[model samples]
Target: MPAVTVANPLALPRVPEPNPLTGTERPVVSVTTAPKGFEGEGFPVRRAFAGVDLRALDPFVHMDQMGEVEYAPGEPKGTPWHPHRGFETVTYMIDGEMAHSDSHGGGGLIGGGDTQWMTAGSGILHIETPPEHLVASGGLFHGIQLWVNLPRARKFAVPRYQDITSDRVALLSSADGGALVRVIAGEVGGHAGPGSTYTPITLVHATLAPGATLTLPWRPDFNALVYALGGAGTAGAERRPLRAGQLAVYGPGGALTVAADPKQDSRTTALDVFILGGEPIREPVAMYGPFVMNSRTELAQAFEDYQAGRLGSIPAAHAEVRAATPDAD
Candidate 1:
């Protein structure tokens, strides 16, 4: 796709001191494209990061679509009760409200600028419903749902949840006044996010201004990828336009550098992107439907548990949408 010029680039907040690391090893970087998400029947959700399957990215499995969509009044806009195992789902809302409820007694409504971090350890049932504002206004909805895999040791760990408002999360500014970086999982600069994670990873949501440029020091041991929510930019040798919902996975490098396309003079448009990096697990992964495990035997056991009504019920009544019937995509 051709580069889409940004009208206004958002300015970055002031940069803080760099993160202190004991070693000189830098994170590996790569640029990759996100494929369309949610292809199965009934579960008609669109995907952006893990297009074909969750295993493609190994340690980090998937990232769903990001953009604004209008849901008609009284329309059911949400995912019904689904099962997940061996991974965590992180939902960041940019607009609209989502009422989420799960099997672990975790339930709440997350509005614009809100986030939900769910660790579907072992197994759990969960669902999300659009709030009145979304249903009434043909609700404008935009956000990202990312999937992070658990290491072999943590695959069967107990489930957990963390609901955070935008204000509660740590925000980091760029030194060059290029962008505002929201640290969701790992440390950026001297600040770290409140969300507790099992792996040593970093997820940064950045907003950049038209002429701004930002560089992040990284550790080479970790694998990293970037997903653009809006605008266009060049990372190293790759010049790419990041439209809403598209993602770019960067190759292994010790640093990440991003700059707004200088030719695009529109100052009203800003660049919104996600920086995700973590240590890669050199282990086997077996995933079927919603459950992921280290082995097919474990996956089968999960299915058996669900069928035997062992997965347990969601703590509260989740706003229910019709259950999506399964099918081969």
Candidate 2:
């Protein structure tokens, strides 16, 4: 829950209130609970985008809320080396540490409020795992991994990586000072985050004090979604109920609303929500396993290219290290 925090939210810049006369409040389209599943070497995850239509999540292929669970020593796990194409993987760590390494020479350690954005435009091979120290000591692990689809034009763009530390996030407050908003990518109320994206999108993590409400100006053309990370809240003008593990998809509008309940469980004192939206791509999507393409033919080509080792080769040094580790398999 400590992705980012401040002693006094009132000190931050306030998001301007939308003009009531012209602003239209979005209505909730549907609310769905995420189903729990295992991912990447058996780490528990909540499939956040499960049961949601791709049209509603345009430009976003998939999302997973990685463990809010505590891991005992030596129990941490992560993905094995894998190849991806025609999409970008955004890994945001709210707590604990994850070590990332790729065949394209991108690597880093991201923890607590940090983010690793990797674009597998054409293709790339990568792996993510808990750092050695973290696996040895055991700790809390909570994070999100979102897959963003690339338009056909940019599907073969150069591979790139961006390491966004917590300090780079744009922090803002509600007019009443009851909420803290962290802008990870895209713009919110004119404040922009550090991460650059191929598609027009906004990603925000907001924490609301009990009984607090936050209304944000939103782009009318972009789709909207609000996910409860912890505690309870209501979304949209219609006041659709939302709780941890739930997702609320919103219909067309110029503004969005989320309000925390008056009381919350002792374990989580405030309402935490992850808000995201993007312009619809509106193109045919043919996705399988790790590749997202516009057609089945392209997906087949991607697989053939991967088999030919065109994506990338594992760094010799890292390969040797992994082979020597007890858990390399």
lDDT tens string, model 1, 1-329?
Answer: 10212233234334444344432323223444555544322223446654433333657876675444555676535766777878888888876677877777778887677789988888777777676666676756677788888988998889888888777767667775467777767776557877788877888877777767767766566766777766777654345454544555565656666666655535327777777888888788886778767898998888788766577664434434444321111
In candidate 1 the C-alpha lDDT for residue 149 amounts to 85
Q: Identify the candidate with maximal lDDT.
A: 2
Any idea how many clashes model 2 has?
A: 0
Candidate 1 RMSD to the real structure = 5.0
Cand. 1 Cα-lDDT: 0.66
TM-scores for every candidate against the unseen true structure? 0.82, 0.96
Q: List the residue pairs that clash in candidate 2.
A: none
What residue runs in model 2 are displaced by over 4 Å at the alpha carbon? 320-329
Q: Against the true structure, candidate 2 has what lDDT?
A: 0.90
Off by over 4 Å in 1: 1-13, 16-46, 50-56, 237-243, 263-268, 314-329
lDDT values of the candidates?
Answer: 0.66, 0.90
